[model samples]
Target: MQIRDLPYADPGRPDVRSGPRFLYWLGRNQLGGQLRSLFWGVVHSGSVALFPLAVGMGVAAVVDRSGARLAAAGGLLLLLGALTALGDTMLHRTAVTNWITAAARVQQLLARKTAELGSALTRRVAAGEVVAVSTGDVEKIGWFVEALSRFVAAAFTTLVVCVALLVYQPALGAVVAAGVPLMALAVLPLLPPATKRADEQREKAGRATELASDTVAGLRVLRGIGGEELFLSRYRSASQEVRRAAVRSARMWALIAAVQVVLPGLLMIAVVWYGALLARDGRIGVGELVTVYGVVTFLLFPLRQFEEIAMAYSFSRPSAQRAAKVLALRRTAVPADDVEAVAGDLKGDLYDPATGLLARSGELTAVVVGDPDAAGRLADRLGGHAAEGAGDSPSVLLGGVALDEVPLDVARTAVLVQDKDPVLLSGTLTELLDVPSSGAVTADAALTAARCDDVLASLAQASPDGSGDPLRTRITERGRSLSGGQRQRLTLARSLVTDPEVLVLDEPTSAVDSHTEARVADGVRALRAGRTTVVFSSSPLLLDRADRVVFLREGTVAAVGAHEDLVRSNPVYRAVVTRQTDEEPDKELVESGKSEPIGESA
Candidate 1:
């Protein structure tokens, strides 16, 4: 495929059984492109191999003082030169095409998998690892794909040249052929160590990259805790480890290069030394001896491809394996063929059989769980997330239909699960809120429901003259320019604008002030009065505003009541929400002060 037709119309499903299998699958997918590359590679290497023959013929013609034969040799040299340039040009074009196309195909596969897995992708794979695979790893994989054809053609040319030399002059050919194989095989034993060093280097580099990414992402938090120097020292140590590993790997590769050069030079010397004796004995002509020397010297160029192919495979194999591992991740439940039929029955309640969590339709239900990890798992199950080890877990029911059995598109449209740490993509405020608006929820309405007026005002003040429209204000990557509360509110606004039938929010106001949380809770209740919304929060302000609060203990529902009722009745619920001992109620604090019983201000 040409680079111009990039981003293939359809990057076909890949075979991701193993690294080598994935590489082979890539080759098979682009068979036509690979064949074209092979053809050009053959032409290029063949022309290079024939160069010594043409020079020898010309020398012989000159020695014989034959004008016609000399002219014929000169014409042959020009043809070979033209072929050499053409073949080299075409091979380069084809190889680059293969590189770009292969990278694009892998990129498409990654994108598809990410969409299929959604947030679970990040849970299964490290964000840094995903970033590495999508960027540098993909290029390395493409490098191997592009190099394969050239290596094949070069190896074939080397064999053909060896056979030709043996037929033309056995004594010199035997010596050169034996030395060439020795040169290629000599590096094999060293390859394992070289590969091991390379793996270590890559691992250390990845760790360093991950550390840097985390440090940058949490720079504000680090500064807040006065731990910047500690993290900096740790990163410095990681960077040094990466550096040492890279130096060791480089030394190994350099040794291999030294071997490649030294072996070929020795072979050339052997041919010349042996050919001189043959010439002295009058068994070979000067022109033929020159030809044998030239052939062996030219053969060195193609022989070097062995080293390149080996190195390429060594680096790319692990990258391919990493990519394959990511691609192999599939959602737990197999979606039914008739999604419409399955969804038709789903209309009453959302049920999670795994955790015994249920949300009544058109009600604002709040779930307060003591354990954050269990809370997260409950959220996943409620949203029909592919459970890691429970592929056979009963499907979450929405209405009467199984949520997992519904088509992915329909399920997403029906239920929107906003994680505790929601991400706000880089864009202007207007662009950020301009999602698939369901007409019932406008940008302004959603922003209001999310209590983002203060956030917008802050953005407006950050702009020129403190008069710029907040909608026009630009947000930095992942909204790093904004505070955590501001980013969370903006993400909430975006999700609200989608106006899905069911909205599941996990700790939506954990980062906001109690006053702001109170406003958000009230706004959400007023706006989603007739809609089904499930919020996972322990904050009393949010829970008090919910129509019903479900208290979860030990991964199961322990109590269900109004926030005030639960706080006064259940000691466990009171301890969780108020963080107080289960003694008599704090009547003075609960009745006299709104802020204390409601939640922490910050």
Candidate 2:
């Protein structure tokens, strides 16, 4: 594939069994690009190697005092120069194209894998590692892929030149051939340490990146708790560690580079000295000595390619391994044979047998879990996402069909779960609200329902001109420029616009005021009047608006009823919803089944 045909429609199924295999797989898929690069590289290296021969011939012609031979030598030099220029130019173009194409393909694969795994990707892989892989690791992998062809061409040209030297003037050629291989192998001993140092540097840098990401994500919270300095200190220490590791890595690579330079210089000196002795003895002509010296100098360029290949492989191997690990992740562990598509319409009750929680069709159900962690897990299960290390297949069902059996797209389409923390990507308000929706709800209506007029006004006021359209206003990354409440409202609005068959929201309004929360609750209930919606929350305002509330304790259904009825009957439910402790005397009496309804008594 050419550069213009980049971003393949299908990046193809990768062989993620191991890092080496993954790298091989990527190369195999781009055979055409590699061949193109290889062809250009051969032309370039061959042309360059022949330059010394042309120069040597010209010198010989001058020494002979033959005009015809001199003219012939000059013409050959001009032709070689043109060929060299053409070959070098094309080789560069092809190499860069290979790099870009490989990087783009890997990026596409990553994006597809990320989309396939959804939130599970983060659960299985650290966010920092993911960031590192997608950013730096990608470039390193591409570098190795692009360097491979050039290295092969250089090695081939070097071998041919050495053999030609052996045949041309065996006396001087023997010394030159013997020394060239020695120069190439001189840096081998340093490669191990260099690779180790590089890996350590990458590890430290990844940690630093993750730390920085976490700190930035929770900057507001850290400031509120007066812990910004603590995090800042920790981050500073991490950054310093990364810096030190980088210095160590750089030092090792510097040593390798030094070896490459010094050894080539030594070989050149040896060749020139030996050639001078041969010339003095009349064993070889002055022009041949010049050729041998010039060839040795040119050989320096190809010799460095050996060190470059070593460095490229050292860096890219681990990067490919990391990428392979991420790509190997599966959203759920259901066997392929068991994956039966949903046979009917994608409308049904969303039920999780693990928790005995069922969200009925065409109804608003609110789940109240005492443990927030359990609530989050349940939400994931309701959306057919098995928890990490969960051995059993996801047992959530839709219309009696196991969710794990249905295709991922089908499952996602049937149930949409919005966790407590929804992220708003950086974009204009209009782009942020634009999503694949059922077309039942308009953006304006969703925004109005989420009570985002104030958010729009603030965005507009924050604009530099202070008079542009609100929808056109650009949001900062993660909506950091907006208040927590505003971000939450905007996210909720985005979710509402989707209008999925089954919408699961976890604490959708925890960041908002009571007044705004109540309005959001009412708006949600009205908008989802005939659609199945499951909300996991404990707020009285939200629970009161629910048609039915399912109370979960220790991951099992403890009570199920209307919010008012549960509040009056179940002491534990009342304690959870009211944010009170069951140890209270009145609550204890109700728990003991010896008192009136807590609501009536209060």
Per-residue lDDT tens digits for candidate 1, residues 108-133, read: 99998888776667777877788888
Error of 2 at 48 (Å): 1.7
282-350: candidate 2 lDDT, tens digit per residue: 999988988888888889889889989999999999999999988887644455555444434556877
- List ranges where model 1 is wrong by over 4 Å: 333-336, 370-381, 386-407, 420-434, 437-497, 508-523, 526-530, 539-541, 553-556, 579-602
Query: Which candidate's lDDT is highest?
Result: 2
How well does model 2 score by local distance difference test? 0.86
Report, for every candidate in turn, its global Cα lDDT versus the true structure.
Answer: 0.84, 0.86
Q: Any residue pairs clashing in model 1, and if so which? A: 346-399, 346-400, 346-401, 347-399, 347-400, 348-399
Q: Each candidate's TM vs. the true structure?
A: 0.84, 0.84
Give the true-structure RMSD of model 2.
Answer: 5.2
